[model samples]
Target: MTTSFPDPAAFVGKVAFISGAASGIGAATAGRLARLGARLVLADRDAERLAAFAAQLATQDVLALNVDVTSMASVEQAIAAGIAHFGGLDLAVNSAGIDLPRCATAHYPAEDWDKVIAVNLTGVFNAVRNQIPAMLARGGGSIVNVSSIMGFRAFAGQPAYTAAKHGVIGLTKAAALDHAAQGVRINAVAPGFIETPLLAHLSEEKKQEAAMLHPVARLGQPDEITSVILFLLSDAASFVTGACYEVDGGYLAR
Candidate 1:
């Protein structure tokens, strides 16, 4: 499907907070939104990388915060800093996540399971929990929680990641229902095998194998996923909420 966005200033004067903004999809989204005129709060655990990226953007329009999403206190502090800097927040995207070493569920390390759940599932809850009231104060806002195609389907060696992503979808739906009447819209985006820093360690052959998993015969790009996220955060998707949009290159279609 061809989509042409004519308005480059669709997000002008808007305040957007994005987690995991150090690199990959989050970094791509941050750049895109900034170009489209949105004031940004970029949060991530990688302080150096986050700072470098934020430095390239207009300093007056961006606040780079070092945040560990797994800790509720860290997330709260980041949100507080953003609000204090930008005055208010109008949109947010939760993209901080982690993947465990491949292993059967029974053989998975308890530590890995705990770490994954803390960063992925509870991390989203932390962001959402704090984001809601800020949006409520603004009278309305939008949120996009980044899930994965694995949220609905099973990956042989990703028990914790799968479970956490699935929980994100459920959380998104519940939040949508709870806030829609008050004008806050919550939704999710499930991306499939995107070419990001997460996959930078894969061998060329392994990357090809992953690409073949999608019917499109190739992996997706970060900007491709960013476009969908931008749409959800903008007024263009005013009627959208509690829905999970799959930008998976047909990976789940099969």
Candidate 2:
């Protein structure tokens, strides 16, 4: 049998910027986008892991930058490096985020809340702040922000995570609207209970419980979310904007 699907590697001349590229969905998406022919600017605070991943990619032009997304100066420098390496950005994915361990609202430390907001919400803003101008310079581009299913549903003991994710949705929609006229398209992916390093800390019983929350009865893989992200960043989805594609295995439906 033969396949007629468009070759994923059609992005040969394009450039993409990805935050949180050190692990999980961010790493998976970076690999996927590279396989699809996009040159990459990979960013994360973990210098060791980031370099290791960059070295493994098939894309040789990969530029690895250690970025603390919470810091505006760090973000600006990363963007400068990206433009220097790839010329200009064609796509950007804001996947740098963190979640506090399950804790009751009353006991949720202000510090933890601040950390989550800084990395998950403000981090995304910092990505957009830097990449938008480069995309605009070239006429237009695409952006994918990683939100969470928790943004749309209530889960006990995750006040900070939920609030930060909700803010991501608002930001995605606002960016989509503001830049659509300028040929830029922005969207988000809201994933649920994926099997990633972030979730590896949970006990077997807790992991099973989390998996059962989704209608599919299994946790999602990072590739599952990456596939959708690649599509949104591709020309195939030029008409789609201000949308949040849920890769939650029907978790939101249950």
* Among all candidates shown, the one with the greatest lDDT: 1
lDDT of each: 0.92, 0.90
TM-score of 2: 0.96
Cα error, candidate 2, residue 109 (Å):
0.6
- In model 1, which regions exceed 4 Å deviation? 1-6
lDDT per residue as tens, model 1, 1-254: 33346467778989999999989899999998888889999999999999999988754699999999999999999999999998998999999887856899889999999999999999999999999999999999999999999898988888999999999999999999999999999999999999998888889999999999999999999999999999998778888999999999998887
> Could you tell me which 10 consecutive residues in candidate 1 have the lowest summed lDDT?
1-10
Q: Stretches of candidate 2 above 4 Å error?
A: 1-9
Question: What tens-digit string does per-residue lDDT give for candidate 2 at 88-158?
Answer: 98999999988768899999999999999999999999999888888999899999999999779868998
